[model samples]
Target chain A: MSVTILYKEQPPFPVMATPDGDDLWLTLDDLRSATGWEIRPEGVCREGQCVPIPEGREREFVRESPPRFNLAALARWLEQPVLHDDVHGVWFFGEAARVRRETLRSLQAPDFRLPDLEGRMHSLANYRGKKIFLVSWASW
Target chain B: MWQGLYDELKDRSFVVLAVALDSGGVASAGQWILAAKPTYPCLIDERHVVAELYSMVNVPSAVWIDEAGRIVRPTEVAGASDAFRTQMDRKTKQVSAEGIADRQRTRTAYLNALRDWTAKGAESPFAVSRDEVRRRSSGPSDEHVFAAAHFRLGEYLYTQGHREAALPYFSEARRLHPASWSYRRQTWELEEPGKAGGPDFWSAVDALGDRSYYPPVTL
Candidate 1:
């Protein structure tokens, strides 16, 4: 069997899939390309951050059939809200925007690491004591 | 826009940092920064993380942080000073067939509010409470989350030199978030042919009709 994966922005792409005990398994490469995430030994990683996949859950996610990951299990590990249309073989993995919105109520800015044009790393933590007038503009 | 504000407020323990969300390429953005010769830090957000972090749907959005690092104002269409509006009016006049009367008025009112906030600080009526900020910006929904994901993917693919592969994702993102001019503007400018120097692009017939993209501020 095969499954067609549909993400929010990109066109739908299909990958070969096979039925497991009760879940469907997709190849590691397909998952990585579709989601921009890789299931490393450290669990799932993008950019530099890695979320360590817990011990027993590793077995639950990985299947020997073409060496793939279970779609449901991957979404659970990432703690992302997911919606799937089984008949259509489509899946949408969303970000933590809801959590982000809630956190905004606390007025505490979310922290992330970014590089300045000079190639120096600057984290929001560095600006902890200083006020930031974060102006978002475009050259266009 | 920030130069005078930054210079004047610098002695008052205030600082202005501009985050340029120029995804297609950095050269033009860099050039603009050089011409301005700002003392404040101007950072580039190739992936537009800062926009996503603040749920900003358009360029020129700003978030005001208090001395304690708390958000005094959530992301809003923020450039109130005359300098900024004059610059905007000049550019919009050149490109847009219609006069930018509405946008000019909006910017004038916004600058007034900004002055009040700067003067009064915590006591200012313009400074929103934490709850009010969140409520007004409106908590993100599934569409917002999905749009953000698509935007990131599109930006990544485009920067990777996979322009063909990136187009569909950009289309989908624009479809999902019609109000988000930042998504469309960045992509559209990349598609722009010839004419490549210093702030020429503005609302075109194709860019969601020839109107001021900036939504009116409540303040």
Candidate 2:
């Protein structure tokens, strides 16, 4: 299953678990909430996890469920922190869970396949028949 | 030691594949592996797929897979050698944290024993036989399974902008699986009445305000 975390004034952070695997889509709000400083392709920090928000095309959509208080206006009233991405018109809130629990070494590992920096798809099945030692670390 | 040991045994029908769980993606993990420059195959699991598959609760936990693709050993913290233990002991005392010595001592012994098994395979005295491994790896109970489902549902709802709706599911998950840090921490992360990064100031010690929800984490 997938989940999305959205902010009042920004886009949403979409975490989807597809049949093939899981994919993460960050809305402008997601980018802002994750990192105090927002710029597409720049780093956003949420709960100590830093995520890279790449620059992309922007789109406008209406909210199906508008609160009695305009979330965007309320966000301003509450003085909630807002960060902006360079390429997108959307704003971001910097208070979302940037890292999922499944990413931790303590959690059960899910099977997945995704392209590498070289654009090659890699999966756990590729390393079957050998002893595997998986270590997780990041630059930031 | 992992590299040295793996190299020594690779020719003997033993292969070591290092999987990196770095979410920063392959380039980040790749740099570290290259710096180490070990001979073994280093792989990356950017999202921690192996961790979830093995129910790994901590780093350095390892599973021994036999030739038949069965896990000869479930996830357990593999200790380093005796020499490494001595170095760790020295470091622990230097840091001087309370209980550090004891924790280090236990960790050292665990690692040393694990290395012994890694070298000896099933021949090592510490090596558990196939039957024992199977017996130890019985799946989580029906309660845990249901709790995991509820916890996932709660997380999903919380992500869907339904914080209020998510509360009951989180509560139910806590009721079903008290020992699971995932359920407890995820709920606790939300229940705190502040922004995401704000501290969890509520000292409710027992996440289940009602004692009937489940047992305490300490229990």
Candidate 3:
């Protein structure tokens, strides 16, 4: 089946997956596409972080027949919040507790890139050299 | 109001970035932005990503970021005062003279503090310390974390033309993080046009009783 992955604040994208009960298993390439993480000899690695797969529990995360990765298990290990809509094949992954904690500790404004009405892209980082009164409102 | 403030401080290197948290996207928020004719950057957040990132529970919430990109103040209610709710005639929806005066006073105080921060940067009394900023920041609780995830899924499903399927997730988000007016209002307005500020909104306000609609401005 195909699944839509909504990762953080980024745009959602779809990837092929094997659904098992409540979990979605994906090939290594699909895993990388769904999440930025890739399985290496060291474990699942992304950027500066490499989490080693638990010894003797490799079967829980890896399947040999078609070679699939258990994204649900990895999410649990990282303490990343994952919400799934079974009927719609959509999954939403939120920031890990540790990541949010680090951001809070840094006391830096979280950066985001969004589009203005004219479809011009603007990033919070672009306004780094000035005082910013960032306010949120709604038409509703 | 924001445009006027932005005009006053833009030359001083201050920027007012207004984010519209509307699930209805450009179709809903663009009209207001067009009318305001703001010179500052006005971005539309169709997915409420800013709310999730900043742990913002309501609209009109704000964060003060310094020149170096440090947060001087974390998310808190910004403009509208309790007087708008408490002092208005329930039938006519008109604010009492006292209410209007009180609302004006609250708005002026907030704006003055903003001006002070723009003028003095880190030295302003209104600029909170790093420790205080960290302390005040609402790191999402487990419920809030899940709530945001559910909200995201709900938004996706709704936009995908699975409107009925989206309701459960939206309801779950609201149940998990009731403090989030953004979650509730977005879901309500998406479910039914104008339901956001309808009688349900007033009932929710009435239910608050002693609790405030917006947290009082600390400055």
Candidate 4:
């Protein structure tokens, strides 16, 4: 199946998956494309961290017969929030709770980059060494 | 209003980064930004990323950041006064003398506090300690986290021309996180032009009872 993956604030990307009930099973390549993770001999590994699949729980996250990885199960294990729009075939993933809590404790302003009316990108990081009154509004 | 403040404080190394949380993107928020003729960096957030990142629930919410990118003040209602709701006629949009006066007073106080912070930096009485800022900041709960994902999915579907298909996800997001006026209002406005402040809004505000619509800014 072809499904869309919406991650963080980036644009959604399409990937191939085999969704069973609520669990979205993707091939190792598709898993790496949708989420920046790959299942290694050690465990599911990303750039900075490696989360080892629990002992005897490998069946829940992997299937050797078809060679598929369960993204929903991995998200659950990592405490990353997931939402599925079955009708549209889209899976949305949110930041892990640990990351948000770390930001909260550090009291650092959460940084973001967004485009202006003319399509010029501005970053919160660019405003360092200045006092920022970051205000959000809406037309409606 | 933000432009005026920005003009006053720009020479002091202060910037007012006004963000528009409109899913309609430039089409909806463009005219307002143009009308302001702002010189500051005015950005449009189609995904409501800033709101989700800062745990902000409503429009006109703000967070103050200092020179080192530390959050001096956490997200809170920026400068709106409740007199608009309490003193104005629902249909006529007429406000009483008291309402105008109260609105002006509250906005002035908020602007003054902002000015003090801009002038004095971390030494300002308005600048809170690191612990206090952390205390005021809220990390999203499991429900809120899921609500954000659902809301983003709804936004994607809506943009992909599946308007009817998008409604259920939007409704689910509202149900999961009722405190987020941004989610509710964004969906309502995208559905219809002026529906955000209509009967549904009044009914919700009335239900608040003694609870405040805008969180009181403790300066």
Candidate 5:
């Protein structure tokens, strides 16, 4: 059956889930949607980094009415920490440790592709090799 | 003075890329951009990617990257100049006297330090060692990382027109990173803008004690 999964990174929604004994499992798709990471052959991947998922995670979390998932396990697979509210069916994923470590070592600004007006695109790479004063301000 | 500084530094191979993190995209920052008529390449960050990636706690926060693409300075409060305090004072008519003073002190210090670093480059006293940069911008503690993710999620939801649903994530982000004014002010302005004018920046400061609003600048 389906159940509500409240993600710290997403609005609460009911997705395909299964009650596997006492632990609740979410569908593979739901897991990907709740977090921005994607399920790929190389494991779970975010924009610039990928970490390997344990063997059988793709098959393991797939099954049932929709399908259940161990979000905590997925968090571990991504080298992140997670908290679940069993009653409300919420999950919170902390940062990925491996990715954080890599970013720390590189000290290179995180790369992102954003669009400017006229729908044209811009990325930090465009200004690479130049001193950049990346300032952030909001109208508010 | 950003454009002025950019003009002077352009020949020196420096550029000031100012990004507006307004959720409303161009619409939000249009007036200021038009008024200033900046010559540099001004960009818009509707999704706040720079803030999330660079740990931008407040507006005018800046990261300085060297020619080699290494961050010479991590994200820190950067005013265009000391005159920023005068503009801020006029803008924030409601901030307590003490808060205003604190803002002036930090603003002048940050501006002078930026000038020193710009003039002296690596030789400047304000330019930190690589190790110190790592220490200042390290993992930033686990809570902050999660807070940033949640903040991004909230920004996405707000952008998607899910203001009501986006609130919890914003609240969580503020709770996790209490010192982050960008997250707090954005959400607060949406929820309850002050009756007189503007977001409740002062009330938020009051809630966190008078002097606790801004973190100490690394000068």
Candidate 6:
């Protein structure tokens, strides 16, 4: 499973997925609030695991455990991220969780067949034995 | 990036396929592809069936499938070349100064990083390891899921001329998934009074009715 964030319906940045066999989608705000990192060009931090947000030159920090509990790390361990809405001050936890690039032990890439401009069939199964790089783009 | 790289590695057991998600069918996407004249298998996804299947929500998104039909790189696969950004930035510096430059700059940077990963593959400095990738791919809560459903239903209804009915779905989509661009864009487009072909209808949220209707766009 994987997590994705959408803005007005379009993907704004790269979506984040967690490990632990859960697939969930997340927004940038969702990641920031859960990790306690400002959305500014700094770094992403939670309880124990923190990833540096390097847009420009930024310093890195060590992942440390909190005395009581690393809620962020616990979220990571559980394969879920905390989500908060600044607009409504509402918060919730996602059930299905996933992380990006983690070797998908159960991920099955969906098969698809679609026509091109000339109405020719383009199928995913055609590239069964080859390393296929599929990209999606639009004119608009 | 993949195009040129594919040319280099195609004979070495590598293949690259480009799918255009253009809603205007192949006409627009084909024109662009032909102009670039990419040597790879450039196809088109008119109905967005592949997008729906792969959970693709944006353009220029990529997925890498190994020979075993396993997804080595999923929906967030970025491109391999920074050519798009370099050209965009250079043109922005020379073009008209109507705020389009800033927009182009930001968009260009985003595309550049994607290209870097594509070119370098897993060796790319920006490429996340299997662990990091998994850690980052998790999605939002159920509220957002229902919101996405509502947004899709609203878009379907709006297209069917059920504007009033669509309004409720769009409203719910926004309320449930406040961060969704699909939900917000659909609603904004419906309420927009401007000409359709002029510019992006929801280019600026400030022009929309209530700023509080959407979340802050950090990108």
lDDT comparison, 2 vs 5, better candidate: 5
Clash statistics: count for each candidate: 0, 23, 0, 0, 4, 44
Q: Best candidate per lDDT, number?
A: 4
Residue pairs that clash (backbone atoms under 3 angstroms), model 1:
none
lDDT of 2 by residue, A77-120 (tens): 33343332222222333221112222222222334464544456
- What's model 5's lDDT at B104? 66
Interface RMSDs of the predictions, in order, are: 3.8, 10.7, 1.0, 1.0, 3.5, 7.2
For candidate 6, the docking band is incorrect
Q: Each prediction's Cα lDDT score?
A: 0.67, 0.44, 0.87, 0.88, 0.66, 0.49
| Model 5 per-residue lDDT at A109 | 75
Q: Write the per-residue lDDT of candidate 3 for residues B1-219, one digit (tens) a residue.
A: 498999999999999999999888899999999998898999999888888778899979999989899899888888668897879887788999999998888888989999998898889998998788888886788888888888888888998899999999899999999999889989999999988888998899889999988888778
Scored by TM against the true chain B, the candidates give 0.78, 0.54, 0.97, 0.97, 0.77, 0.52
Error of model 6, residue B122, in angstroms: 8.3
Candidate 2 docks with a DockQ of: 0.09
Model 6 agreement with the true structure over A1-140: per-residue lDDT tens digits = 23323222222223333322222323445455443433333445444545544334221222223212223343444444344332222223322323311224334465677665567777878878776778876665
Instruction: Give the per-residue lDDT digits (tens) of candidate 2, residues B54-130.
Output: 54433444666644455556555554122222233332334334345655665556556546755676677655565
Candidate 3 colliding pairs: none
Worst lDDT run of 10 residues, candidate 5 chain A, spans A83-92
lDDT of 4 by residue, A105-131 (tens): 788888999999999999999999999
Task: Provide the lDDT at B197 for model 1.
Answer: 26
Clashing pairs for predicted structure model 4, backbone only? none
lDDT of 5 by residue, A40-118 (tens): 6786676677867666656553345554556656665555645443444334455564566568657877776766554
Top candidate (TM-score)? 3
- How would you class the docking of model 4? high
Model 4 chain A weakest 10-residue run by lDDT? A96-105
- Order the numbered candidates by TM-score, best leading: 3, 4, 5, 1, 6, 2
| lDDT: worst 10-residue window of model 3 chain A | A16-25
For model 4, the stretches where C-alpha displacement exceeds 4 angstroms are A40-42, A64-67
